[model samples]
Target: MEMEKAREALMVEEEASELVSRLDVRPHRAGRDASFYEGFALRGIRVDHIQPGLLTCSFKVPPRLTDSSGNLSPGAIANLVDEVGSAALHADGHHMKVSVDMSISYMSTAKVEDELEIISRVLGHKGGYSGTYVLLSNKTTGQIVAEGRHSLFGKLKSKI
Candidate 1:
């Protein structure tokens, strides 16, 4: 039974990867660099607006991301928090950073096919550590689904 489940999971992952490849909606970065958060593209998350110290993204909750109870899973919410939060670091001229800690508060649940807006902002930076805050909100109904805080520590890469 476990082996069967693993095989099924692998098959689902392959299918999602194929769909991502066909979508042609990945974020465009110079030199065609592979984003560290490639799974975001696979899951149909798109950067709606980005600027220094802030990033706004939109996503549709796909059925595959839901728990058996038909609501978005905690893991999926956490993934969004982390990915969106990391993107905010770029606003501070950081090319990369390693997560040091993270926390999330789940305020509400999102159902499959629901549209969500994720807003992330750089809160502070000191001594090679940066803090970010992210909020997930329902686009249509304007309800907050989750909020997250992330701390990261790493060297900020030089732009030039």
Candidate 2:
């Protein structure tokens, strides 16, 4: 009986894998509603400064973004880096760029209520490709929490 059950489970798993393998990706549509992740990551974030090719922001580490042990979650930090780093590229006038590569270095942990200073600066741009660097540091303790480099690419809109 146990062997029969195991065989049935294996078949089910194989079928699931086959279904997933058949799926294909499509380009994102513009009118879709904003995702839950957007709301979760945007809360409590304030733009402290902005200029051509640069962005600086402030955020208080909220409990909702913390791990079980009370430190800020790494995924949340990565999301912040992605968003802010992309925002820094807006000076180039390409509003629809997609991240093609990202590298992040985590240096320290931040706790709930810790104010974090986020700075993003453009590294360079060529045609539709761009690069940027981001830094996240604790405001009070002045400790760097993470640093990231992001590369993005997008097609320019044709003017009719």
C-alpha RMSD of candidate 2: 7.8
Give the alpha-carbon lDDT of every model: 0.87, 0.87
**Per-candidate TM vs. native?**
0.73, 0.76
Model 2 Cα lDDT, one tens digit per residue, 1-160: 9999989877757776896687543454556844455556677889999988899999999998899899999989988988999988885455769999999999999999999999999998888889999999999999999999999988776565
What TM-score quantifies how close candidate 2 is to the native fold? 0.76
Give lDDT tens digits, candidate 1, residues 32-151: 765645644345998999999999999999887898899999999988888889988886578688889999999999999999999999999998899999999999999999999999
Total residue pair clashes for candidate 1: 0
Off by over 4 Å in 1: 1-42, 157-160
RMSD of each: 5.8, 7.8
Q: What is the alpha-carbon lDDT of model 1 when measured against the actual structure? A: 0.87
